[model samples]
Target: MVVERKEEGKEQLIQRPVYYISEALIESKQRYPHYQKLVYAVLRAQRRLAPYFHEHPIKVVASTPLANIIRNRDATGRIDKWAVELGVHNITYESRHAIKSQALADFLADWEEAQQPSSQADLRHWTLHFDGSKNLEGAGAGVVLTSPKGDVVRYVLQLRFEPCTNNMAEYEALLHGMRIAKEMGATRLRCLGDSDLVASQTSGTCDATDANMIAYKRAVDQAGASFAGHIVE
Candidate 1:
């Protein structure tokens, strides 16, 4: 989770990062407890950054005592459903201090050493990359993936139908990065891409005589047979 934006720079305010959200933890939330993983990372960043917490007023720095333990009034079960879902946003809470910029203290020490915590045999195989373009600032597509413990996950798409083509936005960014690496359970994926006609018509050694590239190569061969080992470099 990242969401910076401070600006002003000529001799003052700086902070940069725009938005990045990452979750992946369910195994009983990797055994929470560190103030319930800081109120489950601010209630999973207010439910995955709900439109930037419904247009910003956020401020949650944290050194603990997270807003008096979510306004504790003997908060019960799951901290009373996370203080009633973070009391409908307009949040506040600060405290964490002392990092007067040495390039924002080396980017929060390399984003807290890339958020440590690895092993599961270092997260067995996952790496994807995709791209698509349509020019004139329109049709979009992009997907990144990574995570063998390197964790990357990025996505962006826009192709709002109506005549899209650059190999149909590279098979819609390789079927939107194989449905976000099979919803992140990724049973070994690899799929890097630059689109040699969408990686030779989705790996059938090229032959998609355009009827929308044969229905996007049969929906990318049924999303690469639901991946249990995929490849399409």
Candidate 2:
């Protein structure tokens, strides 16, 4: 868990080893059932962080329905004991609504392997390239998509609306390429673009400042989430 607070009119995020713990379960302890194992992990976390938990309120932010599992009347054995022990703490459980920070985003992305297909047969990989060019004439975008079987598909998009910056054009090309790849049933993709700013922004290395850039980032994130695996370069 991470702790953050406002200090001197600035946000401060702190990491203290005293508040963290990691331990491997013993063979007997590890033999618990899946739901009971989850209960044990939560109980262990709270106990290890007891100093901080005793001083401040603790909230569990998770995608799983932890509360429902603990509150069920049929819970027995270790699950029931762990639930009773956890009830003493001033803790609340809340479902995750959205990614609030880069740390949390990384945590979620680390667990996204579960979203991948179970069967690897006929799994397809895709390569994408995006570029925007403008000279004395109008602006246009060039996109290339490569299939796992060495098939190459290319496209050129001509701007029909108002003139846009090179970065905006790059985003447009990337968005367009991703849409086509999704339609073609590509589950894993690697994207390459000449625009460093656009690539870094899309991959969360840099922040998007302007309204247009922010909107583009949202669109790119939404599209990327549809794929089981995605990497932007």
Candidate 3:
């Protein structure tokens, strides 16, 4: 049986920068940059374009739900100005075309939970390793489902284009991973991810929109029904 996760107050946002990104330090301090991921690319893009203050370090804009930004690329393959979102929203993008590292992280967390370990034998203690090597900009999730009954579903997928939004990819990966889980004969399951919002959302603690989640949720529902017994969280 599947139960909805409890709805709590808005949670803090989680951020993870993309891997191997070489960008300016701050105030044009390129040489002395933060070696590891510190500020999110989206936020950085936003600050670079325009600076503003916010109540939360991470802001989840309350838009019309499937809202998006568009920018044209120059000959150098660089975006000029962000289409940008206007007022009247709980979530705000500091970056012009960014979905934010926190949002992506949330989705990953949810995805991981939905795929928890499915067996009790040698396969029960396994874990999925997501390729956060790309940091917040991009990520790849790889899950190997194994059962005492000689079942296996190895899923490895990567998503590119931070401008398109990593949250969308996270959900896409979840749907893909779930489909793979079914293919591998996983009756019982255990999933894992560092993302927190995603885990809660799948549990029904939070609601996601089209760009962040639409097809993925539908797939999840359909798969849940097919199983004599299944769970999502």
Off by over 4 Å in 3: 1-139, 148-153, 160-163
Q: Residue by residue across 1-233, what tens digits does model 2's lDDT show? A: 76655556555763222333333343455577786767666776775577777888887767777889888788886677777878888888778887555664454555555555666632656999989866567778999999887789999999766768778888889999999999988888888888988876775446689999999998987797677667777
Candidate No. with top TM-score: 2
Give lDDT tens digits, candidate 3, residues 105-202.
Answer: 56557755775655456334223322222455466656565555555657677766564445555555656665666666655444455555555555
Arrange candidates by TM-score, highest first: which order?
A: 2, 3, 1
Which scores higher on TM-score, 1 or 3? 3
Clashing pairs in 1: none
Q: Write the per-residue lDDT of candidate 1 for residues 44-64, one digit (tens) a residue.
A: 667546788888788777778
Top-down lDDT ranking: 2, 1, 3
What is the Å distance of residue 190 in model 2 from its true position? 0.6
Model 2 residue pairs with clashes = none
Lowest summed lDDT window (length 10), candidate 1: 18-27
